[model samples]
Each structure stands twice: as structure tokens, then as C-alpha cells.
Target: MFESIKNLFKKEEVFPCIIFDGKIMKYLDLTQKQIDKLQEENKDWTITKKEEC
Candidate 1:
């Protein structure tokens, strides 16, 4: 019962990626903090989150 309830509240997984100069670089796993840091470091680049379903 608890397992099912926990599953209901589970968050979907996402993969982070960096797009720069028409190039896309995907990461296996990246936290929000890491993504923010990367964005800060590369102002010209773009950081995106892709849901893994």
C-alpha cells in the first residue's frame, strides 16, 4: 500500500542537455544545481531538460 502511494508521488526523470552553436551535448544525469552552474558559466549556451519516459 505504501509502495503504491509512494509511486504515485514519484517524480519523472529528466535528462539535461547543452546546446551550443547548433550542437547538442547530452548528459547521462544532471541535477538542477549543475544545470544552473553550467548556464551561468556559459551565458551564450542553452541548457534544456528532457523528460525520459
Candidate 2:
């Protein structure tokens, strides 16, 4: 199960970081549109980060 979950995450675009609720979350390299959708879904949780190339 852990291997499957790791493989799933490996397939996704690597996110440098994410800032949510005044906290810094690393290792979540999601796209802007994806983050936007997440924010839309959960209005209370805000996410932002300095996009990396």
C-alpha cells in the first residue's frame, strides 16, 4: 500500500512547496490550476508558493 501511494505521488508533478493556514508545507509540487481548484473546494485552506522551474 505504501509503495502504491509512493508510486502515485511519483507520477505527479513535483511541487516545491505549499503555504497553507500560515504554515509551510514542502514536497507538494502541484500546479497552479490544481491548487486553485483545491482552494475552491476548501475555501478555508489557502495555498501559495514561489513557483519553481
Candidate 3:
């Protein structure tokens, strides 16, 4: 069962990082639209580092 789960996970693609300001945040998988939305909503907020989801 554990091996099957591991195999399922292995089939997925992962993104290494999301860089905001000068910081790097790791994320497994995130859509471009989601990221764009976050950036748009947080435009007025000060973010010095990236966020991972």
C-alpha cells in the first residue's frame, strides 16, 4: 500500500520554487492563474519573501 502511494506521488510533476522579492519558496504544484491572482490581490501588501503552497 505504501509503495503504491509512493508510485502515485512519483507520477506527479513538481515546481521547485516561487521567488518573491529576494526570497525563494518551495511549492509542489501551483497553477499560473492562482499565482497571478495572489500577486494581484497582494499588490498593495508588502511581501519580502515568497510563499509556498
Candidate 4:
């Protein structure tokens, strides 16, 4: 019960990613503008969001 209570105050990490050949490549805590730039840079790749870390 104490462990669960402690976890409630802890923050979860999130990441954006581009999947290439069914593999996850995570970019943690990147700004929206940065993600846009990366999208422009990698036009051939598909940008997607990971659930959470």
C-alpha cells in the first residue's frame, strides 16, 4: 500500500518515436518544434507516439 502511494506521486515518462522495420526508436522529452524538424528531416519514415515509459 505504501509503494502504491509513493508511485502515485511519481511522474511517468513519455516519448515520441519513429518505427523503422517494427523497432522502437524513442526520443524522450522533445519539444513539438523539434519533432516537426525531425519529421521534415526524415520524410521517408513514419512518426508515431509511444504509449509511455
Candidate 5:
């Protein structure tokens, strides 16, 4: 039952996000401009990297 429900939303890939100061504020679906802005704001830490298997 649970397996069937999980399979319904299965995806080939997942985009990771960043959690800081008790907030989730990063995503891979951002546009290039948004990414640049984020990079400028959070220069101290690197962005999450995607994994391929």
C-alpha cells in the first residue's frame, strides 16, 4: 500500500535545497538571474550539488 503510493510520485531526479537558520531557501528550479542573486547573497557557502547514478 505504502509502496504503491510512493511509486505514484516517483521521479528520476530530485533537486536538492538548502536549509539555514531554520528556513528552506534554496532550490534548483531557480532561473539564472535568481541563482546569481543567491550566489551574491550567500558567498560564504557553496550550493548543493546534484548526484547522478
Candidate 6:
């Protein structure tokens, strides 16, 4: 019971990404698999991992 309660408060790790398709979109939290699929589908769009500063 306590373990489940603790787990509820825990935040999942996020891999932030940005996609440039003639516009600026920031703080896009996505998994590597999703990013790969997006890149594969959108060849013209530029996608990059966001660096934590």
C-alpha cells in the first residue's frame, strides 16, 4: 500500500525533444522510439533532443 502511494508521487523521466517544421515547438517530451518514428515519417522536418542546462 505504501509502495503504491509512493509510486504515485514519483515523476517519470522525460526525454525532451524539439521539432522544427518551419516553426518552433519546444519542450516536447517523447521517447526514443517515438522520435525515431517521427523522423522516419517526416524526412523534411528537423528534430533534435533538448539539452538540459
lDDT winner between candidates 3 and 6:
6
The reply for model 2, stretches above 4 Å from the true place, is 1-15, 19-27, 51-53
In what order do the candidates fall by TM-score, top score first? 6, 1, 2, 4, 5, 3
Best by TM-score: 6
Task: Put down candidate 1 lDDT per residue, 9-36, tens digits, no spaces.
Answer: 9876555554453476555466766777
lDDT for 5 in candidate 5 is: 95
- Candidate 3, residues 1-53: lDDT per residue as tens digits? 99988897664333444545435443434455555566688674322223433
Q: Candidate 5 has which clashing residue pairs, if any?
A: none
List the candidate 1 regions with Cα displacement exceeding 4 Å: 1-15, 21-24
TM-score to native of every candidate shown = 0.47, 0.45, 0.32, 0.40, 0.36, 0.60
Q: Per-residue error at 16 for model 1, in Å?
A: 3.7
Predictions ranked by lDDT, top down?
6, 1, 2, 4, 5, 3
* Model 6, residue 18: C-alpha shift (Å): 0.9
lDDT of 5: 0.54
- As a TM-score, model 3 comes out at 0.32
Task: Give the higher-lDDT candidate: 1 or 4.
Answer: 1
lDDT of model 3, residue 36: 57
Q: Model 4: runs farther than 4 Å from truth?
A: 1-24, 51-53
Which lDDT tens digits does candidate 2 get at residues 1-53? 89988887675454555656545454476776777788888787756565532
Shift in Å, residue 3, candidate 5? 49
The TM-score of predicted model 5 comes to 0.36
Clashes of 6: 0
Model 6, range 1-53, lDDT digits (tens) per residue?
Answer: 99999999987666788788867665688877788898999898888887743
Clashes (backbone N, CA, C under 3 Å), per candidate, total: 0, 3, 0, 0, 0, 0
